[model samples]
Target: EADIYQTPRYLVIGTGKKITLECSQTMGHDKMYWYQQDPGMELHLIHYSYGVNSTEKGDLSSESTVSRIRTEHFPLTLESARPSHTSQYLCASSDNPLEQYFGPGTRLTVT
Candidate 1:
């Protein structure tokens, strides 16, 4: 039952607030992914890492950033939150690209 976990499942903050979405996995997967989704919309890849200290920006452009300092942790940060940044952020990990384990997801709201 190894799984990915996200903290602060729901968040509400004012514009210009700085926040970090925490994500971690117990399965020790080598590949990690971050995706952003709006309600009723498709998920967009924002960032990914192949291994520790190896990171890359994803297909969809994002203002947020991520770091892969450890095998189990992948956190996304928004320096200054904005209304346009309000969305659901998902964290996923997998040994292979075809199969990914996703976290519960962090729903963010910026006023």
Candidate 2:
């Protein structure tokens, strides 16, 4: 199993609220990524990092941001969330050709 985790398993919040989705891994991987996915859909990469102090936005445009400070931690933040931002946030990490492992995910619903 992957050593990654995400908090709140689920979240329901009002519009315009600031929220942070936590992600962490214990696999000692230097690469981590955050992907946004809706039900029965393909995941869209929104943020990723190569290692500590190295972060970058992914191919997809997103209102969320991420940071990689500690080797085992990568957290995503939304400055002001909206209904449009409601989706499942999946965290994953990989070291090489091995498949990426995903967390249970944080399902956010804005109302």
Candidate 3:
């Protein structure tokens, strides 16, 4: 089973503060991904990693950046926060399509 976790399940900050959304998985999956979601809306892929030391920006445009230095961890950071950046970010890892698992997301609200 995929065991994934995210810290600071919810966040509220001003327009200029920086933030990092943390994600970790215990299933040892090499493929990790980050997705941005909005309430009652579709999800958009923002970043992904194939394995350790390998990372790629996803199809959607985002102000956040991610790193994959370990097989079980992928953390994303934003240099500066803005009201337009508020949303839910989900972390996921998978060994295969059928084995994919998602972390409980981090909800961010920038004022």
- Which lDDT value does model 1 have at 53? 99
| Span of ten consecutive residues with least summed lDDT in model 1 | 96-105
- Measured against the true structure, the TM-scores of the candidates, in listed sequence, are 0.96, 0.96, 0.96
Which residue segments of model 3 deviate by more than 4 Å?
A: none
What lDDT tens digits, residue by residue, belong to model 2 across residues 1-111? Answer: 778999979999999999999998989999999999998999999998999999999989998888888989999999999999999999999888578988989999999
Rank list by lDDT: 1, 3, 2
Task: Give per-model CA RMSD.
Answer: 1.0, 0.8, 1.1
lDDT of 1 by residue, 1-111 (tens): 448899989999999999999999999899999999999999999999999999999999999999999999999999999999999999999997578888999999999
Q: Scored by Cα lDDT, where does model 1 land?
A: 0.94
Model 3 lDDT at residue 90: 93
Question: What's the true lDDT of residue 6 in model 1?
Answer: 95
Give the clashing pairs for model 3: none
TM-score of 1: 0.96
Best model per lDDT: 1
Clashing pairs in model 2, backbone N/Cα/C closer than 3 A: none
